[model samples]
Target: MTVQDIRSFNRFYTHLIGALDHGRHLYAPYTLTESRVLYELAHAPRTDVADLRTQLHLDAGYLTRILDKFERDGLVERGPSERDPRRRRIRLTPRGRETAELLDERARQAVGTLLAGVAPEDRPRLAEALRTVRALLSGGRVPRPEDVVLRAPAPGDLGWIVQRNAALYAAEYGWNAEYEALVARIVADYAQDHDPRRERVWIAELDGRPVGCVMCVRDTAPGAARLRLLLVEPDARGLGIGDRLVAAVVAFAREAGCREVVLWTNDVLAAARRIYRRHGFTPVAEKPHRSFGKDLVGQDWRLDLRAASE
Candidate 1:
């Protein structure tokens, strides 16, 4: 089939699926917006209005109206923030909590009912295809927050980073099987024997989606650490991700009592090389290598934490 034909079919399929889902709504009384607000409040009862606004991307007037309605209905209470009298915080009332819980359970059931017939094996494929479409449409940009957060990787996040990295690098550099296999091995090993104290994976997320990551693992040699599998989504590049990842790794290594940090990369990764150099890493070794069906030059770099601090 031609590209145009495939595109047309995709449009029709999306519209058909959306229509099917829309027709099957079991929640008779709650609007979608109200349900969403309930869901967000379910997890965080005392959320600031500003945070809710950002998360829902709602206009100020509209959000105020919804909050007012919810308050009048005894579903939620809004009051001045305890720490900051100028800001408002919203919390669910006891009755609101019960109602929200019921609604949430019903929503979960609705989703399960929709996907009941789909085979388990096909679910991953469906999700991946949808993600690809979203990435393409958004020009490869991943969700990011305006504020910076440094935290350990959450469940399933490391795997996501590995998957996104493999897919993106494969498409961008024509990397073959070997490179993919290497990333798989790294991720698997980390997952199998994760140590919060000696090794950690840090992820930077925007809008609850991971956009950058770095891993710091304890080295066999005492007082040494290895930095591995650093990556930022292509759309998230040029916003200091590389520098942030590197700095985070360095801080982690120091906190772990490592005297030095080491990393390896291909010479083709010029941008990464520049970031490392800017952060005090120096090339210690270089070699010609052939892997992934391509001949390339690789370099090993090291940054001495003690020396740099001194």
Candidate 2:
């Protein structure tokens, strides 16, 4: 799963970057690796052909060729190291710095353009995900489930909640447009009429994208809260997001002084059922029903938070 996920992301990222002028550094007549070399020279405290070759894992001969090109273009100056005359140190020329700056701006704008549609609220997730990718690729420490962030719905997150849930259910369960409409309606209602004290939504983010979500809303029964719309992305499953989301809802219910928390789900949703059971919810009722283009048994479960909290 890890390998497939990484490969999928690679394909997506490659396509995304390629759309930015085939992944070449825009506004610079340099290939990606060439630009990287310039970036290191511009930023690194000490840079030499040997260090660049080792750090970048480029062949020594190949790195020397790149340096030769940079020197010819007046983008770099090389001289014998002060500490070891046998070794050569490299530095960016003024023109090289100018080129690097241009490359930097182009890169920044390119990323900004890609994320322009992203809600300002979710930018932190994107940053975190980038760090995770770097760490994973570099064979560094990987974050645990507790490292996953649960945040409030940012702009566009509500829409995402509806879209992803609908899409996932449709693909996985053979449900149809009716389910999508239901999700859209639920989101619309929440958006229009949620009470701050009694209603809340949490979006579980992994690597800057919404992987799961849940809502705790005022139940029709007085002093009760309804746990609604719990979902976890397929890739993010087994990471405890569903468990975390349910836990968040239950905790909030207790904090808000709700006497009980309730939820309704189909029996076919085995994983979710297990999560709810672990959190002390007991099945209160079950009935056969036709919904979302399927004939299924719907179960209502409730958690007596007052009892559980004590």
lDDT of model 1, residue 47: 68
* Model 2, CA-based lDDT: 0.82
RMSD of candidates 1 onward, in order: 11.2, 18.0
TM-score of each: 0.55, 0.58
Report the C-alpha lDDT of model 2 over 1-310, residue by residue, as the tens digit. 6789878988998988779666454846888788888876654424566766776778888888999999999988899864588989887776886787688778878877889978989988878888776676657645456446666677789999889988999998988889999889989999999996789898887666688899988999999999999999887887778887887787667767899999999989999999999989999999999999999999999999888856
Clashes of 2: 2
Model 1: how far residue 45 lies from native, Å: 29
Given candidate 1, what's the lDDT at residue 225?
87
